[model samples]
Target: MTDAQLSPLRAEVREFLRAEIDSGAFTPDVDSWMTGFDPTFSRRLGERGWLGMTMPTDYGGRGRTPVERFVVTEEMLAHGAPVAAHWIADRQMAPGILSNGTEQQRRRYIPGISAGTVYFAIGMSEPDAGSDLAGVRTRATDNGDSWTISGTKVWTTGAHIAHAMVLLARTDGTPDDRQQGLSQFVVDLPHPDIEIRPIRSIDGQAHFNEVVFHDAVVDSSALLGRRGHGWQQVMSELAFERSGPERYLSTLPLLRAWSDHLREHGATPNQRVTLGRLTAQAWALRQMSRQVARELSDGGKPDVFAAMVKDLGSTFEGDLVTAIRDASGIVPRREGGTHLERLLAQSVLHTPAFTLRGGTNEILRGIVARGLGIR
Candidate 1:
């Protein structure tokens, strides 16, 4: 569907967010997850049938298309809603399962996910491997009925609060095989052998955690797909990763809030032009993202196109923060005008991860280049 077609749903999501704001479900002057974790907010969203709106209705999802999902997500981020508590679970893991999981897996997991009864974290980035997912040395040894896993994953977002993790480990052969030996498993994180230690970020938030898996036993059923096919599975998942409106829309609420504040104070023509240009760029990026969602819904992988969206989306995200700071004359500190202060603090603290998370800007450009047959 076109952006024009998505307008009605966007309006509906905006109304939903307005109610959340009125009820004080989110703070107007705090970083999304910095203050603390809030499960009640997630339950509220789930109860509204908004949590897994993209999954099939048989599994407790609303069965909406990705375009509709995009509208909900975009509105949430644009309003600066504190979705980080269930962010990785909903955005990455749940979608991954809905796309690639078996019927049993879906029946077992998706309903709980939709009900906010189960939460998941991603176990992809490790201490030694960061973005080089192929270099992940975490090993999972098969024991006929289950796999015994042992390794450390850094930057495992919200591991402490998560019940399970979609973990990637070397399973089949050797690391030299690159894509051949890797596999993805859904390991229960609250087990006795699994350890989770919070890693305090510069923002003074412990949302990120270092997870250690020592003899962490996972059932054979925990394998997300066929063993030794993790590279392919993760690649497909990245299409979901990069295609979402979150890639570019996370900071939109702050930008708009700042813009409104500046206009109320009688901004100059230059400031007005800057805001207009930024808003226009954001709108264009949103359209590109919606196109990728359409492609996904049509049963085609838009890998190349999704890469382009992420590359441009993240660049625009950083640029949006910069423009807002410049135009609104706000400093990146904890104290400023009340709303501007919160936005500046959030933009300052979270902007650094924009180019690095999901996939790095460098990696995305390479994907685009390869798609053009230039690499």
Candidate 2:
């Protein structure tokens, strides 16, 4: 659908957000999708048919198109709505499952995900394997009807609170093979053999975790897609994860707030120029991200393009935060501060991760280069 066609949906989401904020349901936040863990807000979104918009209607979703889903998601992020509780599931895991899960798996997880009653965490990154996912050493051994898994995953977002995690483990082959023999399992959380501990960020928020699986055993049915295909599956999942409105919109609340502040207090010509540049960059990145969403909806793999979008989008997010800070001359204050000040503080604290999550900018550029046969 065209942008004009999507205008009503945008207006509808904005209205809902306005009502929610006016009623004091929640405050707008910077990086809300990562830091805002409001189950109630997520459930409200599900009730509004906003959570699993692009999934099939048979899976309890609205069966909407990617453009439609993009409209809703961009609105949520732009408004800084608290959406983190269901963000990973809706954005990445649900699509992964639909593409590779067994029928039984679909029945078990998709509906709950659509209802916002289920949450998932990613287990692709380990202490030794940040962007080098091929270096992951988590091991899983076959035990007839089950697999015994043992290893530790670091920087696992929301694993402590999630219902399950899609863990990547080496089930066979040598590390020299790199991507071979890696497998994914839908390991349910809170198992007896699993321990999850919080990893606080510079903002002092415990959104990340260190998850250890001590001989944790899961049924053979827990395997997602084909065994030994984890690398391919995960690469596809990252395509979904990286190329999203969230990448660029994390600090949008601050941008909006800064714009309002500028209008109210007036701005110097230099400040106006900076704001214009930032706004133009955000607009361009949004279009790029939308194009990737269109490709995904059409079942096309635009991994290289997705990488480009993420690389540029994340840089834009961090640059936008810095521009806003400099243009407004606002010192970040954590507590007892104005909305703009609080958002600036949060954005500044979260800026370091913008280019690191999903995949680092360096790794993303490498992927793009490889795709172009430049290396």
What's the lDDT for candidate 2?
0.92
Encode model 2's per-residue lDDT on 1-375: one tens digit a residue: 888999999999999999999999999998999989999988989999998888888988889998899999999999999899999999999999999999988888888899998999999888888989998899999999999999999889988779999999999986677999999999987899999999999999999999999999999999999999999999998888989999899998988999999899999999999989988898999889999989988889989998999999999899998888877889899998798999899899999999999899999999999999996
True lDDT of residue 61, candidate 1: 86
**Model 1 CA lDDT for position 339:** 66
User: For residues 1-375, what per-residue lDDT tens digits would candidate 1 score against the true structure?
Assistant: 776888987787788878878988776433353333678877877897778888888999888887777777777777777777776677767878876788888888888788766788889998888888888989999999998999999988788888888999999787677778898988876899998999997877788889998788878889888888899889888888887887887677777787788768888898889989998998899889988988888888898999899999988888888887877777666665576677777787888888887778898898899988995
Per-candidate local distance difference test: 0.81, 0.92
Worst 10-residue lDDT window for candidate 1 reads 28-37
Highest TM-score against the true fold, candidate:
2
Query: How big is the positional error of residue 335 in model 2, measured in Å on the Cα after superposition?
Result: 1.1
75: Cα error in model 2, Å: 0.3
RMSD of each: 2.0, 0.8
Pairs of colliding residues, candidate 2: none
